[model samples]
Target chain A: MKKTLYPVLSVITILAFGFLVMYMLYGSGETPIFIIMAIFAIILGAAILALVWPRFSGTSTVTPGQSPFLVSRGVYFLMVIVLLVSFLLEGFNSSSPWSFLYPSENPFVPILSIAIIVGLYLVLYLRKSVREKYSFVELWTMKANDEREQHIIDDAARKTYGFMRMLVVIMGLGFFAFQLLGMSFPAFSVGYILFLFIFVAHAYFMFLLRKITD
Target chain B: MEKTANRLRELRKVRGQTQEEMAKDLGVTRQTVISIEKGEYIPSTTLALKIARLLKKPVEDIFWLE
Candidate 1:
């Protein structure tokens, strides 16, 4: 069941990602043929790499309970680096450091970012340490392996819900204040808020899991 | 208030089972076994029963109010 489901889901996710990129690049305009070709080329290249990657055997070097912490920290670091790079590029291109926060007009920015993201995701998915414990689909879905893990997940989710509720209320009030002051909310803030939502949820889950497991 | 204490570590050692071995037999991670033995986390009733079965002991024999 998983063997077939995983591949199917992978293809679907990749295709969805490609379409998302296309929409981001040419929302109302016609997408150029080369852009479509480039996206497909990148996807095909990634698929080939996944198929040809050598399978790993032997004990995982990652400590039994430490994988979540390591993965979270790595993801957080990667996001920070990506954000900084985008900021720098935006500043260099437009003389506005905050331009990257808005949707980028340069097609290369989205394409490059998508390629890097897909490439890194494939690398992590194929990593021996991660692969030994979880399948690509399991990793993608964040499936729990045991009752204890499920418990930790549930607790983490509950805490995250509480935290996000508070955060949303505060953000709502801030936005309301902005509206009263006749200030326009930046579109980039919505994207940043979504990023923060994901980051905080993962961080919370990893922190709680590590604390319990340790 | 009474605190819950457990004899999990001692009983596991008496059975000559490593944490990893116990975890495998109990269908849980070694970290779960470690946490239980250290009294850092209490197990659910089902898990407690599973552990009791693995170690050939009763639940009360493994855990008690202290």
Candidate 2:
């Protein structure tokens, strides 16, 4: 089941990448609206397929002492680093006046990003041991995060939420203080700070729950 | 720490059950089962009851407040 679905999903994602490249190269703002919408729809559909397909067709090869949560978290960590580094390098090098992270017209960056993502998925599917490990991980991850886990998570989340709220208040006050002092701060700095906060907070809570629970 | 000590380890060993086996029977992770045995985590009434049922012991025999 998973063996077939993975390849098909990878193909669709690559196809979406092809469409996006062609759209960027050949299509203009005056290009037909339907074409742009179709391109977007293809990309969105492929994204959803990547996440949902395995849930339906996945088979498990769970072995004792192997943890699904650990494997999946490792995968997620790798994917995030790959994605963040790729996009951040692209953004930092961009000459766009609007924002550093503004979507670059350079097709290579987007294509590279797609290639890496597809490569990861394909690599997971092609290797027998890795594939079985991933399947077991997925199975365990699903079962491990049950209602009881959610209750534990919710309690932890409430504390994290309060911390986030306090952070927002401090940032808000700082912004006002800057305004009053006639000092300037880049809007992107605030966005970056918020992004960092969210990412760190989530990772912290996940670690805490995984440690104290299973 | 206010530990809720239990004889789960002894009972499980006597029953010839590994933590992994008990975890599967109780629909939880091996780590969770380990935590319960180590007194690092206290299971809810329902889970304690389920564990008792699986072990074929009274709840009091498996767990008690310390």
Candidate 3:
């Protein structure tokens, strides 16, 4: 089932991207339209990278005992650094006068947009990979059959997913309350705070859940 | 963390079968057979029936309330 779909999806994505690039380079546009199109292109490009990530990337051969925390944290940190640098350069720099930039308005909507695109792809990839790959060692007994092993593996994977979900909602609330009550400046201060909480909680929970997985 | 069954394990050994051989015959992983022998996992009804058939016994005879 999966082997057939992978190649098909990859081809579709490549065709979409090729069209986007050719249209952007050859098509005509002035300042306003150009900026709008550039923003759209950047977003679409990031989304493609995320969506095709699974096809290009192989599963981490890391063992169950191995922690993916450090790697994930490093990736998250690098992302934050890039966004922060871009924000600092664009915003609060009067000489450059890029009017589109504003911290109060979170000029980094494109970054969030990229993250969302990647996240959606990851969710889909994991849903497929976890079931097919895991050996389900704990579930098999000398007396057990294939059906028994499958049932156990399926149940354990689902339980891990459920715990992750709970942790997300819990940690998200934690960050939201911390930010909203701690600081306020903008119109949707409350909403932004909630979003920030959810994002941070996702990182934190990603770290914490590794401990609970085994 | 919980009590489990190994009646199947004892029976399989009495019938003279290795974990690897049993797993092959049952179409499951060796680790599953090990887990069962160690009383770490319980077989489902279908699996229980399969095991019983292999051992030439009834399901109830092979598994009991222990």
How many collisions per candidate?
0, 1, 5
The collision pairs in model 3 are: A140-B32, A141-B32, A141-B33, A141-B36, A142-B33
Arrange candidates, best DockQ first: 1, 3, 2
After superposing candidate 2 on the true structure, give the runs of residues whose Cα lies further than 4 Å from its correct spot. A1-143, A146-148, A186-188, A209-214
Write the residue-wise lDDT of candidate 2 on A1-214 in tens digits. Answer: 6568544644443354334333332323434543665575466445544543443235434333333333234323433453355345644554421133333456465455446655554543445533332353452253333334444444444454345445555665665576689885543344334435445544444434544334
The digit string of per-residue lDDT tens for model 3 on A95-175 reads: 433322343455466457447745753453344333243333211111113544444433333343334334434444544
Model 2 root mean square deviation, Cα atoms: 13.2
Which order, best to worst by lDDT? 1, 2, 3
The prediction achieving the highest DockQ against the true structure is 1
Q: How do the residues B32-58 of candidate 1 rate in per-residue lDDT, one tens digit apiece?
A: 888888887788888899888988888
Residue A117 lDDT, candidate 3, scale 0-100: 48
Give the runs in model 1 whose Cα sits over 4 Å from its true position: A1-140, A186-188
Candidate with best lDDT: 1
Please write out the lDDT profile of model 2 over residues B5-64, one tens digit for every residue: 899999999989999998888987676788788887788788899999998889999998
Of the two candidates 1 and 2, the one with more favorable lDDT, higher being better, is 1
Question: TM-score for the first chain of model 1?
Answer: 0.37
lDDT of 3: 0.47
